[model samples]
Target chain A: MNLSGETKLFLGVIIGTIAIIVLAAVIMSKPTPPAPAYTRNQLIPIGANTKGNASASAFLVEFSDFQCPSCKAFSSVVESLTEKYKDKLFFAYRHFPLDQHPFSRTAAAAAEAAGKQGKFFEAGTYFFANQTNFSDEFFAKAASVLALDATLYEKDRNSNDTKKKIDDDRFFSDTARLPGTPTFFLNGKQLILYDSSELVKAVDEAVK
Target chain B: MKEKFLNDQMTNRILFILSLLGVAIALYVTQSFLRKTPIVCLNSGCELVRKNPASYIAGIPVPAFGLIGYTLLVLLTFLRTTSTKLHKTLLPWIAGITGGGVLFVSWFTYTEAFVIGGFCTWCVISAGNMITMFSLSLYSHSHKK
Candidate 1:
């Protein structure tokens, strides 16, 4: 078939436009690793400090960082799940303070210190709620709001025990090869399903 | 003259079939995204790959782009098959468009394999369709007199 120069130029423009669009799409999308599957057999012992039913058959373990925006966003979902499941679920929160967040370790330390006073969950809730305003003063204010002993809280925050607790959780996170913060494991199995409804269904199945 | 006609007919038929296949795969993904339902996946990574922020461009699903591309290919193929003048005019352009789709699909496939660490079965099917269509279009354009 004979082709005109004008047609060739038009085709070239269409092809170039498509190429640019595809390239832009690819560039805009960030790559993320697939969530890993963890088995119940590999479940580590839940630490002394945790929230929800201690005797529940199903456990939801969250490896979270206070400064992570996704973790903050998921906090309310976790709270709703805890309320809905109540006695049926054991919720364990572990500290996995990422180094990228300048104040994450301090926040983790504050939460751990609050745990020493049986107010870890409360402190965690406060931190996640006020993630943008995290500071030494904020941690102090949270401790006071929880009615924790200010002196004891300060001492505990700087204690080796608190540091070890955070380190231990980090160790478990590393061993599990967690891809990022806000990762959840239900009864030791990673929740790879992204949808909340699907996750709820999975939880219901596990309960059975 | 007869041989050339036969070749054109075969090329058009292949392009039509492949375009249909591409459209089906893209439609499925688009629907899954819109409906907020789990996509049928032989591989476990489909959910992860789909949920990734990378799967969308400015909140628009990537598969929507695939749907548009495949739909265009179908229209182009139909035009090329029905009108001799249009066929000559559109054949090279079809090859170019298919080539671009192939490149895009290749990048998506690479992300699924290397970055996402999980493959979506439907996505793989769509990529396969794009590759086959690109090959057929390139061959037809080159063989054209």
Candidate 2:
């Protein structure tokens, strides 16, 4: 079974053509979206955060990292809503650091340090509010703003307890299927946070 | 010797196409695996391999490696059309490389299934591609007779 050089070249061309076509088709296919946000949510609570005010009737759990810009934006919206709907809504913040973000876990740890100073919510609020100013110097500056003891802030920031708290939060975030930051679970149901309006509508719905 | 060489050349062409088919299926499965991100469950353990840091090397997915490897194998088949002594030596080395790749991926699949506790559809497809390449190489090696 001998084939001429021309025949071999022809076969190669045909194979190449088929390969190119199949590869092109595969690459061109539209990608599927992530899990639908409107789906059910059996909200899993994180460490020491017992669904925050269980009696509040409406619960909103946020999967966020202090260094995340989107989380910062959503934090403001949540704050406004929480103030307006005070005592009617319960808000809980959980850490979910993007793997590539270098300073996210550090910011999370710093927040925990401030929490030890009885300023968990305050530290969380300020951390997201001042995310643009994150650094060693800025962390200390924020601590000063929060009136936390500098000595304890430094010691607690490096403490295993702080790390464990972040890790535990991570576990809950992971279980909740929180892909990236700023994911919200309202009333044990997943809410679409694509836009503030949608979020607000979802939140208002929960309260009703 | 001429007849023997021509026979080997044609056999390589067939083997090349077989490996290419394997590569194509592997690519399909790779895409399938990535589609189910944020893998919610470990029932199948596919998510473990999908999320594994080693799943991609230098940012290129593993299936991409197989795609390129098979394409090169296809090109090498065309090169063998004329019995050049240089290509005769190169073919076995190529075969060995393909075989070694199969072995490496097999171990990866094993680790994913047993150690990581997850089974990735794409990883399985890539493993299947390697097995086909290895088998085709064996067939080609025999065709040298």
Instruction: Please give the CA lDDT of all the candidate structures.
Output: 0.75, 0.67
- Per-residue accuracy of model 1 over B1-145 as CA lDDT, tens digit each: 4255337767876787687678768877886676544576763356556666667779888899999998898778766655578878998878888999989999888887776556778988898888888888877876777
CAPRI-style class, candidate 2: incorrect
Alpha carbon deviation, residue A168, candidate 2 (Å): 1.4
RMSD to native for every prediction? 13.0, 13.3
- Candidate 2: lDDT of A17? 67
Q: What clash pairs does model 1 have?
A: A1-B145
lDDT of 2 by residue, B49-78 (tens): 544455666766566666677667666665
Off by over 4 Å in 2: A1-53, B1-145
On lDDT, the candidate that comes out on top is: 1
Best by TM-score: 1
The fraction of correct interface contacts reproduced by each prediction comes to 0.03, 0.06
lDDT per residue for candidate 2 within A88-151, as digits (tens), equals: 8877777788665677888888888887787877888888777667887887676789998989
